[model samples]
Target: MGKRSMPEVPQTSGPHVPVLLDEVIAALSPLAGKRIVDGTFGAGGYSRALLADGAEVIAIDRDPSVLPFAEALDQEFPGQFSFVAGTFSELDDLSAGRGKIDSVVLDIGVSSMQLDEADRGFSFMRDGPLDMRMGAIGQSAADLVNTLETEALANLLYAFGEERKSRRIAQFIVAAREVAPIVTTLELARIIEKSIGRKPGDAHPATRSFQALRIAVNAEFDQLVEGLFAAERLLEEGGTLAVISFHSLEDRIVKRFFDPAKGGPAQSRHLPQVETAARRWEKIAKAIKPGSEELARNPRARSSILRSGTRTVADARPTSFEGLGMPMVRGT
Candidate 1:
């Protein structure tokens, strides 16, 4: 658990176009005097919108690369905006003493800023270090790929990336690493491509492997679950919690949080079966996807799903990660 080097000043990632902007804004309905947490501040797109709507925004991001964006936004809005250099999982503690949070917006997964910069190692389109760490801390993708056994690596790819050819890919990786350590994004991508040749008009062969490594390096699913629970506790009664997830794994967690049936009983193993109230959400609107216009302008919204709910008066309850559909990698 050590901090990685800070990225260079933000690269030009085009204009910040947050996915499902209008839809999220409508769900939040931020107004003057309202306090909201942009749990994944990324490029500050959501925070900027909340501030413009007269809400006080507490922005959170673990990657130091976003500091320039966060700092500039703070200066632009003065007291209306503030930045917290941390993960969304700690939103409750981070927002403590900030008063009752009226709403929390979590746009999960990698951000445009990270993807656009090859140095961040979030994308294989550009050759860079195999360091897919959102928080810029702890063991990196290079560490896992080099150290993990063939079976463990394959399991990770299948569990996290859902890569059907995980076994073949892992075998190839193990063999290749014997000659030389796989250290760069392109370097690993080449190995996967060599094992499973890519076809024209199909997604990159390395897509799933890259995704799997990034998820493991960041412990993204676990963070998402904790972040959701923290939002449940942080939001005032009748407050809003909106989450935008990029893939099915993430969407599943959000879907369960909003549906009481999938949430199971509101009791934790350590707590009494009887509680004053269930600290879960009262389901709100159905899953919202980006419109045609948004898709045309922002291709990143193609796979995004937005789920939202209103906080009920129930007390926040304890829950397990497995209950939220989070898959575990044994012996990590």
Candidate 2:
């Protein structure tokens, strides 16, 4: 029998420049003996910095490609670092039996490593396969557009991408796909551009469609809700949780979770208002943005917003998954 071939693994080189590096480090306030979770350890930029500051770091990512980099860092730091290959939403499971974590930092949205690589299909600027699964698994953006009904597609585009012409775009996609499947990023981009006429000085015609597709493909918003709640559960009293979000959808979720709100309208007339205990996190700082210096260095940092909060000693009951507006999946 011939030897079976192994699937090719994506190769990543160079380091992902950590955005707002100094700000994140300052917010985290890492010290010796503190255990921290770098939830999105893309290329270990933040993880490397955290370890250098003498904290015990558990760095994690959904992309298994990052495992090699983690291994390299483990060798460099030995006893001070560990890596887990999974989404931050599974923080509780990943930290099972590990006890409380002192701090958790999440750098959300698409990483530069993913966007810069044409093969990953994250950017419309670079043509590649239509696959946009962040973890290299499950349905691709191509699959969703090719398979979903026009109404569902339109809703997804509007809700996730905040695209205004979702119905028109969805109609165009459905019509185009009937003749031929949209197999690549360029194919979809062209269809969307045709549906919605581009403005004179518009950024790219397909930007919103691509963004919508990526969000749907990866269930990015859903995972974010879960991850935030999971981080809240994992933090010890006085522990800090910091998140960097690239879009308003993500920022809104983080903002609401950190703010005080009752779970829902009174369950019944007899039941008193079930005010959610004062939020577990006390907002430490207003949303932080990259200064002109950092933005000049990395334009991608322009939309990024960083929000940090410290956990209070009062045990605020964890928000139910549904209460957080997380889309429920059978088994994610």
In order of appearance, the predictions have TM-scores of 0.91, 0.87
Point out the worst 10-residue segment of candidate 2 by lDDT: 1-10
Model 1 pairs in collision: 279-315
Among residues 3 or more apart in sequence or in different chains, the pairs in candidate 2 whose N, CA or C atoms overlap within 3 Å are: none
Cα lDDT tens digits for candidate 2, 119-205? 888988788999998888999988998999888888888777888898999999999999999988888888999998888998787
Error of 1 at 255 (Å): 0.8
lDDT of 2 at 76: 89
User: Largest lDDT belongs to which candidate?
Assistant: 1
